[model samples]
Target: MNRAAHLLLFAALALPLAACSKVTADNYSRLKPGMAYEDVRGILGKPDKCSDLLAARSCTWGDDKSYISVTFVGDQAVLFQSENIR
Candidate 1:
């Protein structure tokens, strides 16, 4: 293959790996009680989904088989859970 073709192939292969989520054990451990939503967002980028009920907000990242969920009250995280995150 030519040089440009090789470079294009490399970029295509690397893009998805670069875009992988940061929902790993190391980042999960960094979470603590009373952390603000913005703080968690800084580490996890964005939740896959979020819901609000009264003053409590629940947010989750990643898919069902491998995910992280956190419960926040008044913008402060109070509880968190994870599944199959390495």
Candidate 2:
């Protein structure tokens, strides 16, 4: 592989890891009531899991021991919380 190809591959792999690292207390604190879903998504990257029932939606990032969760009702953030995040 050429030098440029190696750099491109490295960047592609590193980008997702960088995104995963965004799950922190500071970022969780950045979430607020009335924020749009896309806004939260931008701050937290893609959620690990999500579910919807009617106009309410719930999304969580990370896993059992540490996680961030946001509850949205009708496209606006209604509540959010985190556990064991640093």
Candidate 3:
């Protein structure tokens, strides 16, 4: 491959990695009781897992380093927790 094509390929591969956002305390601070599910998704992107129940739903976002879990009643967030994964 030519130099320009190699550079283009490198950039194309790196762009997606740059766009990935990690869950952080700042993201957790954005959550509030009664916040809508769509609103939470807006701030945190998408959860790694989600569980739907009869009257509530829960979503978890995490990696090997940290995690945040939010529980929603109806469409609004009612409880949430965050912790470092050791």
Candidate 4:
């Protein structure tokens, strides 16, 4: 295949993989304070784990390479953190 064709094919395949990725810097960057839970889910997909606290709902998503945790009060995200990014 030509170089341009190879690059195009690679991007086509990689884009889907990127979309399926768990919470990482790329996806985590999309999150913002006060974003709705459903909007966050649309960006990062479902959390690997989640729980409810007295004041908020906590959710996490990550793999061995990286992790992100978010706290939501009512339906809005109040805070989030990312760690161990590679």
Quantify all predictions' global Cα lDDT against the true fold: 0.95, 0.92, 0.88, 0.85
Ranking by TM-score: 1, 2, 3, 4
* Candidate 2 per-residue C-alpha lDDT over 1-85 given as tens digits, one digit per residue, 9 for 90 to 100: 9999999999999999766577798998899999999999999989999999999999999988899999999999998888999
Provide TM-scores for the models: 0.82, 0.77, 0.76, 0.69
Worst 10 residues of 4 by lDDT: 18-27
Candidate 1 TM-score to native: 0.82
lDDT of 4 by residue, 1-86 (tens): 99999999999999988776666677888889999989999988888889998879999888645788889998899989888853
Worst 10 residues of 3 by lDDT: 18-27
Q: Per-residue lDDT of 21-76 in model 3, one digit per residue for the tens?
A: 65778888889999999999998888999999998999998864678899999999
- lDDT ranking from best candidate downward: 1, 2, 3, 4
Residue range 4-85, candidate 1, lDDT tens digits: 9999999999999987878999999999999999999999988999999999999999988999999999899999999999
- Give the Å shift of residue 68 in candidate 2: 0.3
**Candidate 4 ranges with C-alpha deviation above 4 Å:** 1-20
Better of 2 and 3 by lDDT: 2
User: TM-score winner among the candidates?
Assistant: 1
Ten residues in sequence with the least summed lDDT for candidate 2: 16-25
Model 1, position 55: C-alpha lDDT score: 94
Q: Which ten residues in a row have the lowest lDDT in candidate 1?
A: 17-26
For model 3, the superposed segments whose C-alpha errors exceed 4 Å read 2-20
